[model samples]
Target chain A: MTDAYSSSRLVAGVRTGQQRSIARMISRIELGAPGVDLELAELYGSAGRAHVVGVTGAPGSGKSSLVSALAASLRRDGKLVGILAVDPSSPFSGGALLGDRIRMSDHSGDGGVYIRSMATRGALGGLARATTDAITVLDAAGMELVLVETVGVGQAEVDIVRTAHTTLVVSIPGTGDEIQTIKAGVLEIADIHVVNKADRDGANRIIRDLTGMLRLGPPTPPGEWRAPVLGTVATEGRGIDALAAALHEHYAFLAAGDGLEQRERAMASARVSAIAQNLVAERLTDSGLGDRAAQILDEVYHRTLDPFSAATALVRVTT
Target chain B: MTDAYSSSRLVAGVRTGQQRSIARMISRIELGAPGVDLELAELYGSAGRAHVVGVTGAPGSGKSSLVSALAASLRRDGKLVGILAVDPSSPFSGGALLGDRIRMSDHSGDGGVYIRSMATRGALGGLARATTDAITVLDAAGMELVLVETVGVGQAEVDIVRTAHTTLVVSIPGTGDEIQTIKAGVLEIADIHVVNKADRDGANRIIRDLTGMLRLGPPTPPGEWRAPVLGTVATEGRGIDALAAALHEHYAFLAAGDGLEQRERAMASARVSAIAQNLVAERLTDSGLGDRAAQILDEVYHRTLDPFSAATALVRVTT
Candidate 1:
């Protein structure tokens, strides 16, 4: 854990192309502290280069397997790839959780592909705060593409997934209930839909249902820019080449950009958000205002004042 | 829409229990500009009386219907309730969408029950920034109890929901196939488990499954309380009375002596987080470094400099 404190140095070394330093640096960033904002800002320069693809769906949907296959295919094409497998944190005791990465141990030795696991520390919905920072680290490390595989932890929006250059929403067969159960937030974010584990009995039906549902929502496009539906039996490494092709085509399409302003806007937004988070953390921890705020809240709880006043009081004490 | 703003003002007027100026004063406070923060701070005295209950679940798990039923039940008990239903925002156009509030129209005439529908404006997982402030307004308005309902917009950490004194997670039957879909963050925050629409065939089985799973998780007792599980057919209004009783009991149980300390600690923590957020936001917006950031990021993209040095330049520019 001490490694996390000096992680900025590791991140720096990694950005300069030190392999071991990059590997260690990523773990530090993934630890998710208030301090990572600075490191992330540092990495911002090298980011926005990689064709980032986010893969997410229900847990145990064989997402990691799909990611593994996809990364292998990308590597075969002589492209350096980075893979992020976000695992669920133990709600009971928050710690290093990697139940999703058990399958990826087989492919660990593949030099061209680097895989890392992330924990959320009981955060609701999507990947932990540090995953993006780690991705930025990987992006700076010169990976041609990055694949972020996450178990959909009951999230509706999956915004983190959507922030990537392209997003793949992978669902398996026999999700008849979830098809109706999940909200529109995740669906709207999808650029490419993958029905993984296609070897199952209801694979064809799931694909059909997904296709029908997708059409009901929005018009995909005029000619070829529409979100495509793909099928893959990921565990057996089937249909991976097609998935890889779809990823490349999406990248090329994005490369032929309509507007760079929107992309720049998104990047600037992330930068601003990161800055805000860092400032707040610093104030709360380093400043004695935290104690005074607690005292005011305690007084309010006793019916002497209110929280709105208490919040205002915090501003005064700090100033 | 104007009514809500006026209603918000009316709330602020009543918060200080100054019923004479309540209507006109509330109108001033409801404008939702930066100035309202000051008025809310002034009314902060009456806010602590309310025990906030946050109700959340996967989308289409009938959260809106359940909240409606719960509010109706509370109204029958002669309790003045404030309801905030948070729904997903449209990706194309951002607006404070009210699409999910149709079920809540029944209480339109009931001045005691204020129902506000909020839209998630794609702020880091589709939540609007003003949500917490709006909730605080409801609290200060002299409403005895506030219910916050969300559509699982994926914001990590969920510190917003953590502010609620109690959180109920509603699930339905036939959710077994999608059982892995339950989020760890939401599940952990549960103070009470509600199986709404229990009239379905698999109701008892869902109960059993919940019990079975809760056992695996082994109730560790959050903040000296063990979350209870209950069943309800919210549409039929069954089990609501018991749910209400349990909630009141929990509220009373929470307010008795030692419980205040716990609640105080939670609020204190929130204040720190709030203070931190404000500081960061102010710095980022006021720095006037947007152009420089864009320029340096452009340079880094072209490989003129590494991200590490680019970030330092950005910091130097801003600072």
Candidate 2:
């Protein structure tokens, strides 16, 4: 069975919407198994096409319901959608237990849609990389819309969701963290804010807090690109329309090419630099430049060398 | 200058109420420079000494002020205190730009106390290993008490504070995330539940929510071992003494040999694993076995081989 899952077959199957093939393809990419790159490269071209919406917030914020409703809305508009629900690995198993997948299980029978879960098994930065590749794979699979739902953000949330076309930073009332969330780097990247469960007490306060803080940030064109903080009760399926409308409004704003160019620019810079770091580091290690590498590593340990220096030297080894 | 920072010097300076040397010594250890380890080992004999207290909660729950007041209370009791504030680094700059540091900056001139801020840089895992090492340095520096305040009970908070003799999870009136916090892995580790800013509107409601949730969790004895939920207005210095007293009471309970042994065991296990991983990774990168790594990297990227396979192949080469 595993042999049947050679890189070529996996890629072919994944392209045709075969679950097993997509799963196998993800494993190959994760493991960096052979032929996955060819599949990924083919995927790369077909990507840059999906309306990738990223959903992230403090947990219990009803992000999954929001994604579900948004997908349903897009489906109503006659577009196929793909959902990637990212879950944290149980430290013991290092695999997504898919506990959160239960929230979106209602869409399992939707033929026009796909949902996949990925885990970070202490891969550090690898989770974000896998997510980007998976989005590409889904794009190549011909999905017109993609929604990414993160289990929760820890220190790595910014790195993971920075790829989305329009990223929503969801927040719940009562977290008393309106300022802290902004400080945590979530506020800077959010194109929309979903004050989820806004029917609850203090919901309006959260919105007001976000507005006040957003004003203090680097000059984002006021009103031209105001992140409409919408109130939503995802569990009861109320206010999802407003959320969807807010998203589309954001989409149209990005379609102006300027907005998208900036998003594309950010993602491109991240991708190029990340791959370069890993690849160059590997090459330097291969060329028996042990002493040179060790010195840099020691300096990094000593705070005398930043990661950029080590990464740059690794890249410069060829030059 | 770094040489004037060992135990004797710090203790001597500390006797004269010199705060700068104490801060510098902790920073030196937190950076984990090459020579810091031996100094740490020399100082280790004096550690296992402090009734280390851990303060953690949501980002805006005012953990810093709570810690500051707690430290102040301890200082009033003539106890030498050390405070370690763990703030998230700005990815833009690799420094701990602690916005909350202002809450505790008033103590900068106090000689019977020390405060140092640590940031999470590129280190993998939750707490930076350097932060862990710095705590050990402070413990050895003859401080009678140490308050280790981490931003939140994200993975890093749990990892860093789990070894504390007493761990307080600070929460505000409304973080509606009481359940989510448990799910995210903070509840299970909290030694005390502190509902800070009791003057806030939702204080009692959160307490009710927390109390109910605590009932649903595995029942622990209502003795000193069970975590108690307390409330305070840390900014106004209300309930600080009570909180400090609770901390000392918890510390005394844990100071009995059982808690001491458990803490030591965890520390030893952490040290061994950390050292083992570092050494093995180094050995693998050295020994001119670099190309096996390169070949493996190439294979992973080509999607012909998975990362696990490459890692295994590289490990075999090390052998």
| Count of clashes in candidate 1 | 5
Give the best candidate by lDDT: 2
Compare the candidates by DockQ and give the number of the best one: 1
- Model 1 chain B: which ten-residue window has the lowest total lDDT? B310-319
What TM-score does model 1 achieve against the real structure?
0.71
Model 1 per-residue lDDT tens digits across residues A1-319: 2355575676677677566877676655655544555566567666767888888776667777788778878888999888876654233233334454565576677767777766554223314445666777788888889898765533322545655778888888885533522443465667798888898889998888778887797675564467888999887889999999998888788667753335545544444444345433434442434555556656755646644454444542110
In model 1, residue pairs whose N, Cα or C atoms come closer than 3 Å (at least 3 residues apart or on different chains), thus clashing, are A280-B276, A306-B44, B9-B26, B9-B27, B10-B26
Tens digits of per-residue lDDT for model 2, B114-182:
777776554333244566666666776678888888865554566567657778888787665554455
What's the CA error at residue B177 for candidate 1, in Å? 7.4
Candidate 2 residues lying further than 4 Å off, grouped into runs, are: A1-81, A87-109, A116-147, A151-154, A159-319, B1-18, B29-42, B89-101, B174-185, B199-205, B221-224, B271-289, B316-319
**i-RMSD of all predictions:** 7.4, 11.8
Query: Among all windows of ten consecutive residues in candidate 2 chain B, which has the lowest summed lDDT?
Result: B310-319
Task: Give the DockQ (C-alpha) for candidate 2.
Answer: 0.06
Q: What is the lDDT of residue A122 in candidate 2?
A: 36
Cα displacement (Å) at residue A30, model 2:
14
